[model samples]
Target chain A: MNVIYTDNNATTQVAPEVLEEMLPYFSNQYGNPSSIHSFGGNVGKKIEEARSKIASLLGASSNEIVLTSCGTESDSTAILAALNSNPEKKHIVTTRVEHPAVKNLYEHLSRKGYRATFVPVDKDGNIDMEYLLKNLTGDTAMVSIMWANNETGVIFPIPEIAEEVKERGIVFHTDAVQAVGKIPINLAEVNVDMLSLSGHKLHAPKGVGVLYVRKGTKFSPFMIGGHQENGRRGGTENTASIIALGKAAELAAAHLDEENTRVKTLRDKLETELLKRVPNCIINGDRGNRLPNTTSIAFEYVEGESILMMMDQYGICASSGSACTSGSLEPSHVLRAMGVPFTAAHGSIRFSLSIYNTEEEIDFIIEKLPPIIERLRNMSPFWQEMKKKSA
Target chain B: MWDYTDKVKDHFLNPRNVGEIEDADGVGDVGSLACGDALKLFLKLDEHKRIKDAKFQTFGCASAIASSSALTEMIKGLTLEEAKKISNENIAEYLGGLPKEKMHCSVMGRDALEKAISHIKGEEEKKIEGEIVCECFGVTDREIERAVRENHLTSIKDVTDYVKAGGGCQNCHEKIQAIIDGILGVERPAKKEAPKLTNIQKIRLIEETLEREITPTLKKDGGDIALIDVDGDRVLVKLRGTCASCSKSELTLKHYVESKLRELVAPELEVEEVQ
Candidate 1:
């Protein structure tokens, strides 16, 4: 069976070009960047070159970028550094719909003598900017928010938020792990104090991420060890992944136009046709201001895991915010936070596309998905009840 | 990403007895849309009181649908008395075995079967008998106790896996633990008698109690406490951060902190704020 990979939000397939670029780093060019020898000195230069590529993609300075193991590390380093830098300040602000990388950390902070204000989101997955502004205080150490939500693909107004946070002298951070490659970001134009991007979310191999800290931002290190990442983060670099991420960034920059045009068209077509064909289904986010390559659709009355299982039979990969899929009793926090009805929340399916996806794949999904939904609905007791009530 | 058995996959892909049994002798519905799963079981009995036909309509994950399908197949030829004896374990065993977390799917099947049997016998549906424990999932103490005893569940997580009792908010973990302890017949540790102390020993103990018992809970609410002095039976302390600004600091000190100290230390001790 031919694999139709549409679960890019979870992780993307590593681009072949990125793998080719990283092959030499793992074998022939395996010198530690920290060593003083010429062989190692050459590796240090390559690392700087890689850093510059990633920096260019984000419109940031090479010096501002700190490479870490993954997006979670970048988030931890940013948030913890803000708290540690201003130990006297015991308050933090975030949204209720953040990725666990930031949400769990904020929750942990709340348990450890910090006041955490979780700004709410409306049913369309739009944040309450007034609530966010009102929550900011002199005692707030940091405000961490995601640029684009992982499950809903709803884009937040980060630049405007950053400006407000900076005016109040509060450190602002954005988890752009899902936003960086798919959406255009010019950090030089935005006043964000810190931003996190994961390599694997694009077409790079896993286990590498970048944390961009503005030049004047107060800094404290999370991983205390030998001098690495300019002492902002520690341990020897994941050399191969770093190299691959650099190549992926360059490709992402080149493919940005294709992502917005072709990929967006495919995503829209898939979403539009599925909704047209399937009865009683609803989209779960602000359709206008969302990531170009993602769609979250909730097929009412049928469970999402069952839909995913049926899709899996045809080698079509996708994901769900359903309770059963997450091993939790409630649905996705993003859906619940947006006040999506329980009838729809438990059946939300997220299909995130990548540049590699073709129109044929989208068409194939459109053909296959409606019947699956119909079949599951036929088996659902809720569906029968709904039909009977309507009748 | 669940490691579902081949039997489970087969049952889910080609579910058995999928439909409503019109003019059925008994019908039972369990779970709800809010709980992320629901099942409706229908049974048609012959003149001899044997199940002539059984069918189900389910809204759930693969294992749940499969469990419901398996239940209908299992009860098709059995008498009502024989069907009443079917346990969740038997339903799970029929499908080779379900994932530990997916055991609740099997439990849903058993609950529907029991309800259907009760419906046929003209019995009142079992009322929620005990106080609600886990408010997030609306799981009652009776439900938790029954799941614990039947599944031989040992941990709060196991109970969650079997019945989704402590799966959300988790405010009722301590209560769930108490229930599990009651069922397991584990003796509660005997309370240690308060040790007699000199002035220095008393001060040290008071400080230790504040640090170990009182401070962490206060910290969770963005507050902190400091031991100022221990004079006679009175323990003086200072509140900081949100506690200092809070209108309920006195209540916290007199009720929460003081009560905890009295329980852990000498019962005659009185707590006061230095400020």
Candidate 2:
């Protein structure tokens, strides 16, 4: 069996076209983009082109974007910038579901005498707007919310929240790593002040990301060194990766409509089939509004690792919400926050799709997974004896 | 994943003496749904106080299943004294050696066996003459000391690996350590504390906790819990009758079980849900 890659949310394999576009900067185009020479100036043009391509995707101007090494760096740059820009504002409002990249930073800030209000989410993984609104005060520096959650794929109401922050003259930022290519992002329409995105999430190379700093937002550079990214970000440009990210962004913009329709259908098909075939199975998050390519399922009884290992035996790859896999002694916080049972939490699997996934591949997995679950359940003393006791 | 030997896999895949023994002389059930695993051992004792037949049903992860299966196989045809002599080490050895993390699976098996023998001897509620060291699982100093003597356990964590002592909330961890230090005759070595339970032990603790705390609470609410299995630290269990579709408050079973197990056995045990 060909190994199916379903953990796209973790990090995607670089697209062939993106890699091809990046190959030149490793040798042929090695000049510093800021040098006075034509070779360096030519390198600068390519960077601008990539930046423009990225800008086109997000409905922002090329100059508004500042390239960074990764999503964390982008997030750190935006958040710390907002904090440092307004020393008087001591409070930061955020959601409970933000990735550790933001969560850890907020925690560190809290430790350093800054107050952070963590707004709660409902059982559906939706953040409470009223709670968020009530928490936003005069002392609030910024309202940083993830555009879409990494684990549950719950789409946060970014525009609604951003509009509220904008009215208060407070900064609004969003980590768009999981949302960039999966959803239609229009900064021109949304009231967000800053947005962070990673290249690897969209089949571009890792170690490259972009932070869109709205033209008039006050900012401070996170990486302090020689002037780069127009003095807004520091470090020698990851030229090849940036170009690849641009090409990948171009591809994403080109195929958005088709990929959205096709991938969502396949995701829905896999989810529906698995639910039908496997007993006591359930979908983790809301089905109506979510990423087109992600489907999380909870298999009641079997642990996620056992399911994942069996899936590996048949070359079906997926991610899990189990604590054992997450290096925590507990299951995924997203599932826990949603009041998912401990039994199902460890047994939960996330099947995240990409453009490359096919209906036949989904069918193959659907056809193969149920029996594996049944086999595991049959081996279970609880499952087998319970049936007998009940009968 | 646990580094389960072929023997462990064999026993887990084709577990010997599965199902129940009708009119069993004694049935000792331990572990729990919240603890992520549990075992119900059915025993038939001979006139000479020897185990004529031993069978088990486990609800937990792969290692717990293997441990229960291996344990049942180890006790059959052995005298009650011989079965009591079957330490977790002997069970692990019979399974060709479980991973350090998974050592608790075998330990749970041994605990179940001892409990079965104790029950057969009419000693379920009888307390031994030893100070309580691990309050989470009701493990006494004698139990920890015995585990050390039989298994040559060097550390408090090792004792937990073999007997699930000090595996839970760890309020009694210092007490467990004191017992271990006193038994090892080491002048208290001042060192940073170590987590008591291995990954597998954590799962057994969770099952033990669920059995001890969670299920009884559910039973009080007119519901019941049945453990499924312990795979690593993930426990699998099934809710019966009302618990299956009971009010959302049943979620408390998992938290109560996990916290109680972590409190009593080891902090690492996680309660997992099963169908």
Candidate 3:
């Protein structure tokens, strides 16, 4: 079975080059960077090299890069740190469509006496800037927004929102986990004070992430263990993973152009073909302004898990509206928030491509998916009854 | 992904007797588009009152499709009476047991079969006649109450799974819960109910508790729970959908809900894990 991975938004495979760069740190350069020996000195230099590479991707100073375990920790750190930094500011400004890494944390914080204003989004999953601006107040301590949504792939106007928040001197942070490699982001050009990225989202290993805390941003550490990460995070460095992340950053920067063109073509082809071949299908997000490689499609009258499982028989790995919240009978909250009816929302499937997905794979999916829908619809009581109702 | 039987996979991949049989002897269709999954089964009965051919079209997920496929396959050559005997459990068993969450897919299949049978009998569709309480799925107050009486539904969430009452918009959960309370006469607040001591009462209580609390939680998981029996406080229960025989069943039962039940009702209710 040829495995075609279309779940890049969930995580990406580690690129060979990134893995090659990390191997030595596990074996030869095994000394702790904090050690005062030649082996340690070599590891220390490599960590700095990695930090500089990561910093370049975000257009932030190298000193601002604080290594963390994963994107969630980075988000938890940034949000909680900002709240802790400003003790008197009780209000938090965020969007309703944020990843649970941000949304759940905000809700948790809200339960703890912190007032949260969850700004709503339009039907396209785009946050209303005017609503966000109207909600901001003197008591607002921070504005936590994401660069790109994981489900719908809708890109927020982060820089503009940041500029608006920055004018008021309110701390601004973005969970840019899905945006870093797929989009061009430079802290120098954008006014965002803090940003989070996950190594696994790119072609790097999991359990490795970076938080770019811009200079002059009031910051406090969420994890208070050691003097590591410049006393910003308190654990021993995940040395090997961090080194791999740096190499991945270099590859991401170099391959950005190819990814945008190549992956985008495959994605567009998949969406266009499925839309054309399958009747009653609709694209879920902002078509033109969203991620180049992400497409969320809702096949009317068919649930997502059935489509995904049938696709899996062909070794096509993708995600679905019903699959993520597998235990929760609810359809995708992201879709629900976008005002997509339950009929369509539960049937939505997300095909998130990376540079590795080929045209042949997309073609195979195009061939396989329609039959799956047809087959599922044939047994659908609702569709049968719907025809009866209509007739 | 759900653990579909090869039979289910085969049916899902190449469903038999697909599409609508136009101008058929009888057509039985149940569910609404808003119900997330629905089935319409068409039957052509022979002179002997046997179903010679059955075709179906469904609007749902994998299990729904497979269930419809399985239903058509199961009913071929069966007498009308024999076909009527086919239960949702029989259809699910034909597919080597469906995921509990996807069990509704099978239920949809059964509803379609019953409706088809009813249609052939010259009865108009048995639409639940009452006030439309659940605006999301158009479930009626009588329908919600009936599910409560038949399925022993204890909560609004259970009512949603059995009949898709409050699955959408969720504006009618309280209304559905009110129906369950009215029908079951469950006066103790779900949080304040005491655990039953006798076997039958314990079983009844377990069903009541599930109808009330566990169904909502399981419905949230794209699944549902049913009370099998009560061996003292050792409640023998069957898990469905993603939860059925799942690896996390213990954690889900022991830690998540059972702990809550212990805190609320009986501290000694032993929820034994069953297939």
Candidate 4:
């Protein structure tokens, strides 16, 4: 069966071009970049070339980017570095809707005797900037927020927040794993001290990520080992995935316009047509400030897993912020934080499109999904009670 | 993705008897909107009061929908007495079985059937019989106990899977464990009240605890510890055997020896590694 993949925010398929660029590194060109031999020295050049390409994607210099295992490691390195370097500061601040990479770490840090404050969000998944700013004080060692939420795709105004945070003399970082390629980010203009991006989110293979550290930012290493990544991260380079990430970054730059236009249109059309066709449905995030490729929709009185299961029969892939899907008794914390009701939170489906998605795939989903929702609603006793109440 | 059986997939994709039976003898409604799943069962009886038709409207996941469809299919042509006897396991067995996490879907089927039968008997749905344990899911102690006793559930996670108890907030996990241990006849080690000990008494208890609790385990790794002297709360020790020259001997002394001594003998006792 032909598959219509729309769950790009979860992870994208490795672009063919990236795979082609990485093929040589996996086999014939397997020389260690740290080795002194010419074969090894030549591969080092390719690693630097890949770094420059990734650096160009974020408007950072080659020296500023330190390759790491993944986005989670980058986040840990950045936060731990800030806290360790500034031992006098005892508090750490972050938004409530951070991905587990940052949120769980902060919770763990709080248990380890550091004060932690998670700023709340409004019903539209919009961060409470006032509350975030008010919580920042002289004691805060670092402030780490996200550029775009992974589940809801609501983009935060990082540049403005970075400037505000820096003025307070606190180290500012953003987990731009979801935002790096989907949205335009020029770190040259943004005052963020640190930024993180995962390769797999932008059509690169997994196991490779980059942490862009601004020059003159006080730093410490998370991984203490071999003097790789300029002793910033010590793991032997993930040669193949790093090369793949470089190729993926180049492709992302070339396709940035198409991603913003065609992909955004497809995402918008899917949301508009789905809402129009299905009743008792509402979108989850702020429409104006969200990532162009994402739309989280909530269908009331029906569960998300059932909707996703029905969609899967037609080979249409998607994701949900539902508790049943995640094996948690409660729905997604992001949705709950936004005050999405239990009725809708259990049925929130996220359709995150990429440049690979087409108009026809959106049309197919638009045609097939409404009936599935209606079918589930028909079997829903609440739906019957709702109609009776109205009648 | 859930590895749903072909039977589950079939039933979920095409549910049976999926509309309200308008002229029904009984209607049973269970679960709530906030709980993420609910079911309404409609039963129609024959002239002889046997179940001639059964229909349902459910709001949940694949296993839930499949279980509802399977329940409607299972209860047909059975008397109220026979239909009421159908268990959650029977419904799960009917569909080749559900994932352990999705077992609540089968429980939902059984609860709806029980409610439908009670509705026809003109019984005011009995008030909840026990104190609520899991506040997140509104699960009760009696329900949790029954699930543990029936399913031979051992862990809090097992209880949660069977009855959705201790699945939320986790404030009631200890309560659930108490209930499980009660049913399973397991004696829990009582919380030891640390009695105040004199200087000599504390030192003796520390040595006793080391011999009885710590020595046997340490001997497994060719390691041993000898108490030097006790100065107030500090118990200095000499690491012997393989632990004597080990690089992590200090770590073992502080992390393992001190913690065990503190926990078992006296909370104030500290272990220091000495030559």
Best by DockQ: 1
Would you list the rank order by lDDT, best first? 1, 4, 3, 2
Local accuracy by lDDT, each model: 0.93, 0.82, 0.83, 0.92
For candidate 2, write residues B1-275 as lDDT tens digits: 55668887677656787777888887877765444556889999888877899888775556777888888877888888888888778888888888775676777888788788888888755556587777756677887888787777888678766666676666777777777777778786578676666666665656666677777878887777777887766566677767778766445555676677667875555666675
Q: Give candidate 4 misplaced runs (Cα > 4 Å).
A: B191-275
Shift of residue A142 alpha carbon in model 2, Å: 2.0
Q: Cα lDDT for residue A93, model 1?
A: 98
Q: Which DockQ value does candidate 1 get?
A: 0.69
**Alpha-carbon RMSD to native, per candidate:** 7.7, 19.5, 14.6, 5.3
For residues A147-266, write the lDDT of model 1, one tens digit per residue: 999998999999999999999999999999999888899988999999999999999988999999999898988898989989988899888899899899999999999999999999
Docking class of 3: acceptable
- Per-residue lDDT over B1-275 for candidate 4, one digit per residue giving the tens place of the 0 to 100 score: 89889999999998999998999999989898888888999999999999999999999999999999999999999999999889899999999989999998899889889988999989998999999999998999998888887677899999888888777788898888999898889999999876788887887888898899888888999999888899998898898999897899878888898888877887777777766
lDDT of 3: 0.83
Point to the candidate with the largest lDDT.
Answer: 1
lDDT of 3 at A52: 95
lDDT of 4 by residue, A11-125 (tens): 9999999999999998999999999998998888889999999999999999999999899999999999999889879999998899999999999999888999999999988
